[model samples]
Target: MSAKVSPSPPLYTTFLVYCALQVAFVSFLFSYYDIEVGPIIQPVVKWVIEKAEEIPLVKRTFELLRTLVIGDEVNEENTKTLKKSTPKQKEATVEVHPLDADLSYLPVFSSEQLSFFDGSRPSKDVCLALLGRVYNVQKGHKHYAPGGGYHFFAGRDATRAFVTGDFTEAGLIDDVSGLSHQDILGIQEWSNFYEKEYKLVGLLQGTYYDAEGHLTERMREVIGLIEDAKLWKAAQTKEAEVFPPCNSEWHKDSGGRVWCTTKSGGIHREWAGVPRKLFNPGTKTSRCACVKNFGPPLSNYADVDEEGTRGDLDNPNLREYPGCSPTSNSCKLQED
Candidate 1:
């Protein structure tokens, strides 16, 4: 038999197919970000390419995307000015005029220009951003200044970095929408720190916000996540204070008794008696005392002793359960 031959696709058809795939691939990459900006980018990119076609290849939109996509730091000052062109926009604006005169002077910053203020250029004013807002840390020049401890965060949107404690290149990205509840609370702590120590400047302009300062779903998620984190912390604190972990020591021959910060009567690991903290109102003393068979206590065992376990907590007990550690256990509760 003669050798079989296969026909190749037309030259234009092959080019067109690849061209469509290229467009789809670019769109897919951009889909990871705010889809609202897709239309804007397309037109703007078309215009840019037309204008700069004769210019160097490095100046093209594809090159910019390549740089941003490959994690090549997008640290340049985004010179393009952003504005709230929409009059009827109902989105949250990054405007804050605190009643306190001290905090009222902070200026607003769009995401584009955030790097300029990141304390790197000592010649320029020092600033730091959190929760899509900027702050003037000029007062704490020593800490935020060049060579300062946080200088690594000087040229970026470091929202995720603050929560994850990853100040290195890996954790320095601003999009922290994917963090867990605990991480969100971490961000809240940093936010509180900045609010108290530094003066608020203004809101940032990207990721959680648009050019017009309109907040996005990612920003709303952060807000809710922060609230959830705080609530979770508070619930954990109350749990530790009220029903502390039971700490016990075993003697092998005798049953080891366990006591918790709750001061509820010592619990016999083998016994099922409902343990209650014996509280003496007159002496303000409390101790954990168990009633026989987990029933009501009789008059003789009612002498309660309580000094309030707020300051003095039994963390050895906490370490046993690990649930009652509540932030950190006291030094006395742990041995070297």
Candidate 2:
């Protein structure tokens, strides 16, 4: 008999060889392709699925199946979740009060970005809107009263206004407008906070609020002093410049920490109790004579007294770490 044709090379074996070739081809493509195939393929599949979801029949089928399996459980869970969530609007529609002329053009810093509220009346609306924006709570009689309370997690003016108003109502604040020298410094200390962290550098560059406006003078002075001394410039020389938009190019450590620098023969250094030294890039240390004596302290965010001695409130400076204030001693700066 003629040698039986080799049964078409055995369909099973042929199929296995075909599969192996396919796998090899894919491996080769992965090794040789310059373009990123993973990202390209994933998005393409994702877009196709998204497009398919828009079809009426496909959407209906998905909803029907979804309802069939866990409809009641999902419905109950959704109701419970809704009950726990605050009924805050994304943006406030309330009219701003006219008396807050200077407080208009209020800015909300969120997601590391700024959102400005522009309208005829920005004070009430801005403050009220911030209550919802920061705490996710809308304004109402309950929110206005003591028990309703507020949240200042944003730590920006929007949050500060809410905290100031809340504290004033709580009788914790005697004067919102007439802060003393100590209070001004204490306020400066508190201003260093970013929600709950010891940011080190970001706080000095951030904008703080002043309901009574006393803090404004001190803040301007500090800003001017630091700018005049080219503290930021010096800091930039030590680290990479990572200042935010609308902010000047300034040094930020890898941990998102920033430092404020000043050059005024280092006079402000004594008042603030910060030590200055020649930066040591190799060891990431400071050689300034003052650093050794003053301990090269980071700034604190504490509640302040009229004399500027650090104090505490429901909120403390450097929320993550309590009892860590800026180094208490002062010293003269040394030249590089």
Candidate with maximal lDDT: 1
lDDT against the true structure, per candidate, is 0.54, 0.34
Q: lDDT per residue, candidate 2, 155-203, as tens digits? A: 2234333234454424332222443333333433443332122211111
Q: What RMSD, rounded to one decimal, does every model reach?
A: 27.0, 24.8
Model 2 residue runs over 4 Å out of place are: 1-178, 192-336
Candidate 2 has a TM-score of 0.18
TM-score of 1: 0.44
- TM-score of each predicted structure versus truth: 0.44, 0.18
* Candidate 1 positional error at 54, Å: 99
Best by TM-score: 1
List the lowest-lDDT window of 10 residues for candidate 1.
315-324
